[model samples]
Target: MSKSQVEVNRFKVKAQLMQLESDPIAVEEPLQISLVQNNKSEIFSLTMRTPGHDKELVYGLLFSEGIIENSDDVERLESQLHEGERQINQQEVILAEDISIEWSRFGRSYASYSGCGLCGKTSLQALELKQSRALKPIKSKIDNGLIRRLKALLAEQPLFSQTGGVHAAGLVYEKQGELILSKTPFFEDVGRHNALDKLIGHELLANDLNQAGLLLLSGRIGFELVQKAIMAGYSTIVALGAPSNLAIQAANQFNVALIGFAKDQSFNLYTADKNKVVCREPLD
Candidate 1:
C-alpha cells in the first residue's frame, strides 16, 4: 500500500507539561520528470511532492506546461524507484513521434517547491502559459447543499485526519443537473498545487478531461491553480480559502468560474458572471 503519512515520535511541551507521543507526518520527497523524444532525453523538472500518483503528477506537469495536449501525445510513461528505496524518485515520459517539443521556450532552471507553484521563474511573464485554443465554457451549477457537504468529504480524508499537514483537491461532476462527486480522485500533498496536479493528472490518464465538473480545492485559490485548471480544461474552481488578486484576474481572463472561502453553503464568487453561479438562496 502507498503510505501517505509516516509515524514518528514527538515531544509536546505545554504549561510545564511534557509528553512524548507518536504522530503521523505527511511525507515529502523529490520527483524528477524527464522527457524523451526521438531517442533524445532531457530533464524537464524536479519537484518536491508527496510520494503517490507519480504518473499522474507527470501528466499534470506536462499538460500544465503545454508540453502535451492530448493523452495520445504521450507514447509511454515509466516510473522507477531507486534500489532499497520505498518511494519512486524518477519518472520518464516519452512523447509521440510526430509531436515536436519547443525546447527553447521551456529551457529554464526550475526547482519546484512544495509551497508554491510559480517557483524558479525569473520573470512574471514566464508564469503566463499560452494555450493553442481557449478553454471551452462550462455550463453547470452546483447547489449550496452540495457545497456544504464538501466539509464532510474533507473530514473523511485519512491522511489529513492523521497528519493535519496536507492540502487536498477533488473533482465533482453533475448528474441529471445535480452535482455528484462519486469516487472522485482525492489527492493530498504538502503542496496545494501538487494535490491539484495529481487530480488533473489522474483525470488526464483516463482521457476524461472533457467531463463537466468543478475542481474543489481544500485551500486557497492561487494563480498557479487557476492556470493549471485552465490547462487541464476545468471550467469551475471552488476553494475552502480565499482567492488571490492575480488568481481572480486569471480566472476572469480565461472565463473560469472561481469560488473561494466556501463553508456551510456560503462562498465568495471571485470571477465569472453573477449569472454563472446559481445559488438556492442568497449567499454571502
Candidate 2:
C-alpha cells in the first residue's frame, strides 16, 4: 500500500500566497463494460471516468443509453488496478435463451460527457427513443418558503462548504411549517450530471423514482440536468443557483417545473404553465 500522489497548486492574491488542492484532477480509469454473448466470447467497451461506483455507473450508463435495459443483461464483473491501469474484467452474459443487442453502439469514444449532453449524433434521436415520456406538470405551488429552504439546505452541504469542488443531489423532505431537510442518498461527483445519474441508478434499482423529490444542486441548472430530471420522471427541479437558457428551454418543452436562484426567499420559475408559480408578479 502507498499514499496516492495528488496535485496542489499555488497562487497569489492581495500580496498573499494561496495554495489549494483541486480535487478531481482526472485520473485515467477504465470503464470495462461487458456483455457475454453465446457465440464465442465476451464483448467490452473501455471508457474513462473519474472513478468510483464503476459498477452501478456502468449499468446506469448502459441502461440510460438503451444499450442494456436490465440487470439481466449483465454477465459478470471483475476489477483490478495493475500497472496503474484500472482493468475491469467482464464476463460475457449468457442467458438461458437467445438475446439480441445492437452491440455496435456501446463504444465510449462516441459518448459525450454527461454534463455536455448535446452532440449532433445523440441529440434528437435520444430524445425520441429514451426520454419520450410526457412529464407530469407541477400540481402544487412553491412559495417563498420553499425557495428559502432550498438555498439553506444547499448551503448546509458540508462537502462543497469545504471542497467547493463536488456536486450533490438530494431529496428534500418538508416537515413542520417552514422547516425542510433533505435526505441524501447520493453525494459524490465532479459533475452534477454524474451525481444525478448515480442517484437515479440506485433509485431505479429500488423501484423508487416517483419520489423524484426536490433536487438541490451546488451550481446552476444546466441543460443535461434538466433533461435527465425530466427523463427520470421528476416534474419539479429546484437549483440553489441559476438556470442556463438552454436548461429553461428544455424544461419548458418537457413540462418540468424549472426553479432556479433559490436563495433569500427568491426563485425564478421557468415553466409557469406547469409549475404553480405566479403567472403575474407584483414586481410589475
- Among the numbered candidates, top lDDT falls to 1
Number of the top-ranking candidate, with TM-score as the measure = 1
Error of 1 at 158 (Å): 1.6
Model 1 lDDT tens row, 153-242: 887788999999999999876555556766666899998988988898888799877777778899976567887888887788888876
Measured by TM-score, how close is model 2 to the native structure? 0.51
List where candidate 1 sits over 4 angstroms from the true fold.
1-108, 111-114, 117-120, 132-137, 281-284
Which pairs clash (backbone N, Cα, C closer than 3 Å) in model 1? none
Which digits, one per residue and each the tens of the lDDT, describe model 2 over residues 191-245? 7877788877876787766553555566667666777777777777877665654
C-alpha lDDT values of all predictions: 0.71, 0.54
